[model samples]
Target: MDSKKSIHLLYAQYLANKISKDDLALLLDQLASMSTEELALLTAKFHSSEQISDLKNTEFNSQKTLAFIQDKIVVEEPRKRNKFTAWNTIIALAASISIFLLFKVIYQKDSSLFRATQDSSLSSISNQAYLSLILPSGETLHYSKDLQLLSNNSLALPTKDVKLNVLEKGQLAFEFSLEFIEKFKNKTYLIATGSQASCTIRLMDGTLVNMNGKSSIQLPTIFSKEFRTIALHGEAFFDVSHHKTWPFKISAKETEITVLGTSFNVKAYQSDSHVLTSLSSGSVALDNGTHQVKLTPGMEGYATKSKGEFNTRKISIQEIGMWRSGFFTFHEEPIIDIIQKLAQWYDIDDIQVVNDHRETFSGSLSKDKSLTQILKQLEKVSNSKFEITERRILIMR
Candidate 1:
């Protein structure tokens, strides 16, 4: 009559509904004393696909019993028990916490734990009121400004509202209230975003556009049409929400990307003569106002303005769109190209390439990292020497 064997028999009988109603109530009452680690183990076991399926396909009130069990799985640890449970309830508990901890160990031998999702009221919007974006070039810009940077666009504000601020030479922001959005229906709501380098925006339909530095997104004052649309100049990345009912469309330089649903990132900088569209999921068509090239996942379609031609090739997602993620993700990019990106993000007026073709580098870096940090990493990885002055950086390989 081993204690572990006796407990297993009791647990199995309880699962089989052989336990009485009073016994069930007593078990539920013991739940409040469980520890975080114990509860986490229980959660891991309860959320298993096999257990969930068993609970679902079973008959004879099994679903109710399972729900009841899951609800009682959350319990505060001994040290933090005072935070969640009443002191009276804590002392009156019949079962020892050790038994529960053993039960958890047996049920969740290998699964990991995750935090519980809290329920929220339905009145909230997904948008953030304020956010600071650091571009791949190292420019941290606050895109909260009046609608002044955008031509032919206007903003509506509350009576005593705080006017948004755009740091020294940063771009503008546009966050319209639902009411204002409704008022401007059909009319275009345009605004500039990104640092002297790049910026991003989420459309009404949940699609995101990364605005390469010095680009604008043209939107309807209010979205009423089926299509989510945008225009680009420099470069941009798009994780277009899959809207099978309507197409997500983007026009950049001389190229256009059209898809009903997909995960693709686009880059069309001014110095580059082409629009590079990299796909992550689904399919997209890259058109040069006349001819179009279809792209599959892992492939990038390059449409050049000079040749008026479309070329498709496979590329890594990190290599192209990491700019939106606040880092310069480069793959075989030349030193000159790296310098140009550094120039844009650091807001350097000019770059002197002491030795351009003699050197090149590759690596990932946080856009928020100071010039000194970036230079150090760059110098180390590229096997080059970096000399830093007040606002200029010199690289010698």
Candidate 2:
């Protein structure tokens, strides 16, 4: 049954003055999962309905329950119908207050919520956060979930210039030392760009780093032919400085790659539980803690959640790295999963279902298009309908 329809049925009974106390408690449980956007549209649709005021009378610990449910930041609380202290009890008792209050006691204790970690300390477990970064140079940088800092070699950065500093989270800026570069090969300089920014450092050793946005890199304000190396987090496109005798080492989120100067890209976001490394120009060996996979250009390596399950396979280069072009393209992705991607992109937290498993979809959807337009196209293909409320999308069957 549609939970919304069930809620309305219960509300209708209240308005008709025929509802027992238990049905009222059941409705409160349903309201807890309602997002702020859901509540606004709900109130708008029902404001003129006579059931509105009657439902207001349905009390949770009297006035306290009302205040809690109506609070702007209410978290979802699953409301299942109580098996006991329901209409059966109402019928057993001859319309007495004694039986009704006992029903409230039986129901209220279980629904009480104690928020253990408030917003400030919830970063570790929370998908949402108010992240900001500050530079040692006193500049502010916006933070992205996938941002990395790399320190290796740069034309301008004297090899391993330890003094280079990143001022903020999303800002890309690096410095090179001329002292190390004065005697180095190409006499190149280090560069830093912004979110989704790219840094291409042409070192004396002829190596490169394509820093993806929200990424940073530093180098030897000097260069060495013996060993070419750098560290990374977030994502970066790399074409290492080749040296047969000197191996280039790249490190990120508990994964490392040592190569004889090859070409590849690592999209290892610290926020991501797994690291995705794609070979682009040359062969590179990938490592998770215990397992390692070696890949030639055009192959990909994935380290799974379980420690021993590292997997390596080949993927289309264009599909995996399309975000560099400011878009995400999906192929053969499930309709529900597609909606989920949209939800995260728009920062939406509400996605309701028609509770069916057989529906799925295809076709290219734009990230820049409206949620309604995308959903509408999907609905047309699946021969289904959907309801949109502010940021939420509900599948209608």
Clash numbers, per candidate: 6, 21
Residue-level lDDT tens digits of model 2 in 21-47: 556556566655555455545555544
* The 10-residue segment with the lowest total lDDT in model 1: 114-123
Alpha-carbon lDDT, every model: 0.52, 0.51
Candidate 1, residue 263: lDDT:
75
lDDT of 1 by residue, 1-397 (tens): 6643544444444555454434444555444444556455454643454543343211112223334344444332224444235433433332323234333443343221100000011011111112332211122223333323222112332422223333333433345556544554444534444344454466657666666554445555444455666555446677777878888777665566789887777766555557778888889987664577898888998855544678778877546566776787666777767766766566444555566465546676788887678777776666567676765667676
- The residue ranges of model 1 lying beyond 4 angstroms of the native Cα positions read 1-183, 194-200, 210-215, 224-226, 317-320, 354-358, 380-397
* Reference-based TM-score, model 2: 0.43
Predicted model with the maximum lDDT: 1
Please identify model 2 stretches exceeding 4 Å from their true place: 1-207, 211-227, 317-320, 335-397
